[model samples]
Target: MSTRPPFTLYGSNASPYSCKMRALMRYRRLHFTWVPLNPMEMASHPNPNIRALKAKVIPVLEWPDGRVLNDSTVIIDALEAEFRDGRTVVPPAGPARFLAKLLEDFFDEWLMKAMFNRRWSSEVDRDWSGRWIISDQLMSAPELVTLPSPSQTSGLIKFFRDRQVGRLALVGCEDDKLWQHVMYEVVGALDMQLRSGDACRFLLGPHPTCADFALFGVLKQLSLDHTAGRFIQDHFDAAYGWVLAMDDLSGLETDVDWKSLHMDTPAVKKILKLISAMYMPYLVANGKATRGEWVEVEFHLDDGQTFRHKEKFGPYQKKCLDDLKRHYEQLTAS
Candidate 1:
């Protein structure tokens, strides 16, 4: 008999990271309770769990033994190690394993700006997302479960819009096109790779890996956001189909051995080309800036496009690169 405390997840529907954690939990077939938070609770709740997170972010997991975990990547990594013998989202070893982590970081970090802009840049998206968040999250509480008046809804939209716009500006994504371009290039690459002959149902193989789920979280949001959904349907329909297939968790729960599978293949290479060409330089420059160094970088993509940016490094991005390197080192050592 297992005495492990039941796994509990705290997050909001509006959070892509939460969706990532939720989907992974579903794929793992772990029994857990989801505690979705409304904006009020997220901001003002007195829960020590929230304070313990330090970042005040959702998608924080409460482990059975009373340990609280933060960040989707950190939470997923810890859980994957704990349940390594079960249906896994990462390869046991090899280039495929590293590629999976890289793709996950790409989706989690780079794609996030686009995801945020797509949802908050436009008035239509802002209103839609605002309504959805309030309805879905607030309704769970008896005291907060009523439809807001038109005026109240407008107020809520403005409130969210102001906050999100500030975020976009701070991230240097004030120009919606910056994030839009990121979305366009990534989806364009994904479309081509998925249509390639060697393309599997999932990114890494026939099953979903961290790469697939990480991308899935962002794509799922894009599919739901009125603006991004139309863009996906109009330009990269193939990638949209991949999103639907990855949503099926029941199909992934099996005894198949990931180590026996050949993971280094053409499909992965195509995806890696985009990461190395477009993401690596930016990541490197960002890392240097984090340590108080100034940098100007020119990043070129596999499709012969180039982007040059002069900026200071970001702390969070520095941590992302460090985590990726740590994982790579561990994989090689094993």
Candidate 2:
């Protein structure tokens, strides 16, 4: 076995979580390689570039010992455990740590909903998805690649919007400028609260912690597109710039410039929940009860499985962690 620390990342250049992981690797100087994922493929298929790890999702981190960790948070946790060189990605313990997690969750899930809603809501997104999101090698004919229909687009937009009903959802009624205004305000609020009169320039101080990268990940996503992406780059320019600094420290590879990568592509339009929420409740219908308990939910993407989802969650979240754990235990039982 090679004694060198083995780190392999399964993610795409466009994935924000992947970017977050990349930023972490560079920040801490962790060693790792990256793998990109493309749809329309099986493990052995000559096309689709790469197959998704769990139902075609990205950001799967594989360790040198062959331990595969899914979800950005979980992977980050794994990094902290293995890279115990005294360099900490989180504060020394206190309210700062708690606040970091809360706010990170808020921005990661909520803000993503708003930003991508606008990106995918346009005609530009529809045309672009064809060019970038799907896999060309998977299909014999370029025209054969399928995309979400016009009506599907409208429904997806509405789906994200409606899900924000109860949450402190903050996109401004489908208008990009309004959305930017709100986004800028939110970032300002975080900057004020975290740094409030402290000598620390980062969210905690001195060292970049989880809070710093968490905010950066969400903000990075916001800045991905230049056309409708002016909110973070324009209003929160300083804070947005910090994301690059963190990315340098992080160990992931990102191709596009923060200010220049946004385009009208179907991939940009589609808002994906983190794999962690795969079992979480998702919003499906208005005025309906969602998969209230995490223990009962299991998200499926296939035709028969997808239909079983209750749209009542209104983009709600659920996770059957215990059940999954039990199942895992059973499978490994001797």
Candidate 3:
């Protein structure tokens, strides 16, 4: 029998999957030892972490009693099933369980594309692309992974953009005047439920359950609370506060070494930057700002008088918005 404690984690702290378990345990206050793992580390371990798991992935959980777990959902569920110390991620399993699963997968898969695409987007100079690229730009770059060929990444992006990803996102095709409103509404709904009052912190209940952690994974993609756009303030007072309670997971792009970006291409980078810039403004006009709180972004066409969304925004607004349509279409089609 291994001398390790009842909980031992063979994974890296930086991994999203790993973080899912870590965050769950953090709120639950479960004690576990994190045994670090990477491709290289796994290769050398004749113990064969891969052989035990059908595929290559991180965040394998091994209990001190000699039980091993693979897959984040499996691990969390197993823990919830076997060890319910009066704190559960959900009430007796039912529709809530299934909804939690769907939400977790949504954040993990669908949101990843937008998150990936946003990284390369910036008004970066040409010279900087070569120097900064993935390696230099990252706050803590992963070991340079020999990812699939650049051509392969392009193919995947094309496939993801065209066929695979958007089907689920468009399951809720919005016809709102501004897309940000629709996006934040969904976020706001979840936040409102979680933070029933200023004090009600957990999204589901007293402690974060699997459902809560799953939502956290997706929300992590959006920027931090300090973002210029008062996305939280405008949409729902609790949008930022609820997420903050879960520990901010929004700052993932800065630390990852993403593949498939053509940083050398200035136009592409500008497009990306444009996408990010639009988010703040989009949040303002479309999201939580009531008419009373709203400030007009443009002057009246007839008079110097300004108005909120109705007239202040002009051809320039239309121009920027038109540009956004193409990007959203790209995202939607993806």
What TM-score does structure 3 among the candidates reach?
A: 0.48
Name the regions of candidate 2 deviating beyond 4 angstroms: 1-3, 39-56, 125-182, 190-199, 250-289, 292-316, 319-334
| lDDT of candidate 1 over 112-148, digit per residue (tens) | 7679889888889887877776667556654664666
RMSD (CA, Å), each prediction = 3.1, 13.2, 17.1
What do the candidate models score in CA lDDT, each in turn? Answer: 0.75, 0.48, 0.45
Give the per-residue lDDT of model 2 (tens digit) for 166-248.
23222212434434433544565544443445334555434556656766776666566544456556655556656666667
Candidate 2: worst-modelled 10 consecutive residues by lDDT:
261-270
Local lDDT at 143 for model 2: 43
**TM-score, every prediction:** 0.86, 0.57, 0.48
Looking at model 1, residue 270 earns an lDDT score of 58
Highest TM-score, which number? 1
Q: Ranking by TM-score, best first?
A: 1, 2, 3
Candidate 2 accuracy as lDDT: 0.48
Model 3 poorest ten-residue lDDT run: 252-261
**Higher-TM-score candidate of 1 and 2:** 1
Q: Is candidate 1 or candidate 2 better by lDDT?
A: 1
Q: Residue-wise lDDT of candidate 3 within 98-134, one digit each (tens)?
A: 3344444444432333333222222231122222232
